[model samples]
Target: MKIVFLIAAMMATGLIDSAVAAPKSSKQRCEIVKKKIRDIESRMRAGYSASQGIRLEQRLRELKKDRYRYCR
Candidate 1:
């Protein structure tokens, strides 16, 4: 039980750490953002359910914001 809890805590913190980590270079970051934008656009074209479309649109907006901030 104690070991399981310890592992769970470590996994939780690891996820937080990875999520907070940034790309090593601006070019790489911009490329990643661009690729994500393309992927999202393709998925949008392929068609999603209404709820999934809303979520993807929100994420695309956030990615576009990041691209504006970093890619330009």
Candidate 2:
């Protein structure tokens, strides 16, 4: 009961916002993917723990695949 109430309150306050606003244009979508790829690459260059590295590498591959789809 308390947990449910807390979750509702958090969502109402936007503290746990999970909405994913996809880009409305192909150009914008491609740009977003490129930006995300850049960000993840930067984080990798900055260094990460083994588990985090694995996750980031996997995400990078997914982003690259999407980049091909969106950019061309």
Each model's lDDT comes to: 0.74, 0.77
Question: After best superposition, candidate 1 residue 40: deviation in angstroms?
Answer: 0.4
Clashes of 2: 0
- Candidate 2, residues 1-72: lDDT per residue as tens digits? 998996795455333434788689888989978877887888789898998688778888988998999999
Best by lDDT: 2
Best-performing candidate as measured by TM-score: 2
What CA RMSD would you report for each candidate?
A: 7.8, 7.1
Please report, as a residue range, the 10-residue window in candidate 2 with the lowest summed lDDT: 9-18
List TM-score per model, in order.
0.69, 0.72
The local lDDT score (0 to 100) that residue 34 gets in candidate 1 is: 85
